[model samples]
Target: MDPVTGSVAPRKILIACIGNIFFGDDGFGVEVARQLMIRRYPSHVQVVDFGIRGMDLAYTLLEDFDELVLVDTVSWGRPPGTLYLIEPDLELIAQAGERGVFLDAHSLDPVKILSFARSLGAAPIHTSLVGCEPESLGSEEDEISVGLSPTVQAMIPAAIAMLDKLVAELSFAKKVEVTSKGAT
Candidate 1:
């Protein structure tokens, strides 16, 4: 028996972390997603640590998902260890635009992935981002940057808290939407 055929579709939620783990702060997404998976999130939440694959993100989004959260280290002109939340600003994003960036360790850039998602109509209406100041982009030792340092690691708890809240909001919202649709 195909269990999935009879089962209710999992209410989809995708949390994607995109970065190069070898490049210090650039690895924030992979690390955070890794830690997050250790927890018991709702059955619907699917977390993926996309390491440095940006262009491929579009394919992932093609899956049925009510909510999607993308995680990456972003430079907001802030000093290292600083963390920032990127509000869903499609215009701001399109304006900022995208270009290919090569990592000594990996492939693809976040902007390119987002751009692809946008073009494909695969984007979730409620999208958000967490950006961390990158202290180191390249180094042989493969150490977390001094700029990101110990202080920055402290931010992970807060970021996780933020993720929890967002998930709850989307979960509740989806429920309400589904209920409303069934009623009509």
Candidate 2:
């Protein structure tokens, strides 16, 4: 906060995109990160693509950021291409250390990463997640399907729109829950 005005400083946001392109629609985050990188965003907003690198992302999470937004493919029994925003319960996540802070070299586990960061004494960050329903993900060891399904690919623009809105709100010190509802 500013000492003179007693006003809070604008929050810095880290948009961490995680995915493995070989897992089909699981590559949503990677693709989204690529698209976001081509556009212009505020200096306070950092967009990163840590595809299948759990440890790299975890260390990045330890940085002092006011807001963290994780973008990935989330399956919540919703129709394919459905975009939803989820504000994770950080307290619950911290307590459920039952999952442990194990990092797999092949996948990105946000929960474990966050827990591990907290265990490392990093301060709690206000985290929000933006996920798209996947149409198909190659989860088989023998399967190496690449790229995103048509449905999930279509939602990239909506995801970018959501982040743009979020960045704007962060500057104003407001919290918002968004859906891909009006996004073209």
Candidate 3:
């Protein structure tokens, strides 16, 4: 409860948007953050465009959050613009760390970041990934492209809808947990 407001403070939720806007469809996460910013969210929800700053994201993870949602483009051999709600396995992330898989300073790898955060004894209680399949990563000329491909661009609405649903579910779960604790 907040002393000044005399109201219960909401559980903190961090929506980390990971992507490189210059790499065509790799900008999916950034765009999602942009769109979400214009909309209203619960007081405890923070939507940040982390871009490709892996180190910054790693440090930010130390600030505990009830939930962390990562938005990015994932290539799973699916059709372009396909959206996926993934629950990353923490054990698998730890295993990857043991295998010597590491994170690049300029690249945002959600799994790697989670593993690193765990190493530092700081990880969100719940972590989820909201990914979109990309048509292209702008590898043609090795130069940056400023926008998403048509296929990927078309799925922004779907991605936002999915995010809204996830946030609502998490918020409700948090409320239920608080109520149960009080009852106990």
Candidate 4:
């Protein structure tokens, strides 16, 4: 426990980086994970690059964690490289039905993964996504691209900043929860 805050010192945080490195800007999440690995985070924080492994991510969700942060490339029809921080709506997930089906092995579908996890048992109470808009998912020749485009590459720092802010907010919320529990 933290004496100053009267709360637990660390809350388990799972940062799941989801994407396919072979698909140009779709590799954004993988790159973010690579960059974050170079830095240090609290011991309770587990950062992993799932990299198109939807099933693996679903299984990881079974582990106890206070929060889950998903980083990926999202197509929201904005400019290429636009960053977004979204708290996925559980209501929508619930409405989407519970089925653990994937059309492709390389598909990085968070909604499907979450549904599968929920079906298994419990999922993290808190979840957020740091997403980037992609300019191109592959090469002009319709072949797989190995790296991100220039615009997407430039947004990495911005995405990292967003992730940092989200982490701080989750930490504060955890402290508040502990303080309230102690008071009661």
Q: Highest TM-score among the candidates is held by which one?
A: 2
Clashes of 4: 0
Query: CA shift at 111, candidate 4, in angstroms?
Result: 0.1
- C-alpha lDDT (0 to 100) for residue 104 of candidate 4: 59
lDDT of 1 at 123: 42
Off by over 4 Å in 4: 1-5, 99-103, 140-142, 174-184
lDDT of 2: 0.82
Quote the positional error of residue 19 for candidate 1 in Å. Answer: 0.9
Model 4, residue 99: distance off in Å is 5.9
How many clashes in each structure?
0, 0, 0, 0
Q: Tell me the TM-score of each prediction against the true structure.
A: 0.70, 0.87, 0.85, 0.86
- After TM-score superposition, what is the CA distance of residue 11 in candidate 2 from its true location, in Å? 0.8
Instruction: Write one digit per residue (lDDT tens) for candidate 4, span 49-77.
Output: 99999888888889888788999999999
Global Cα lDDT for candidate 3: 0.83
lDDT of 2 by residue, 64-166 (tens): 7878889998989989999988877766666645556667787878888877777776667777899999999986877999988888998999998997887
RMSD, every candidate, angstroms: 7.0, 5.9, 4.9, 4.8
Question: Which ranking of candidates, highest lDDT first?
Answer: 3, 2, 4, 1
lDDT of 1 by residue, 1-184 (tens): 2486874454467888877766667777777888898998877898888887765676787777766688778877788767776655554445433443223325656555655665566643456687677666766565544323454566777778888877776665633221111211
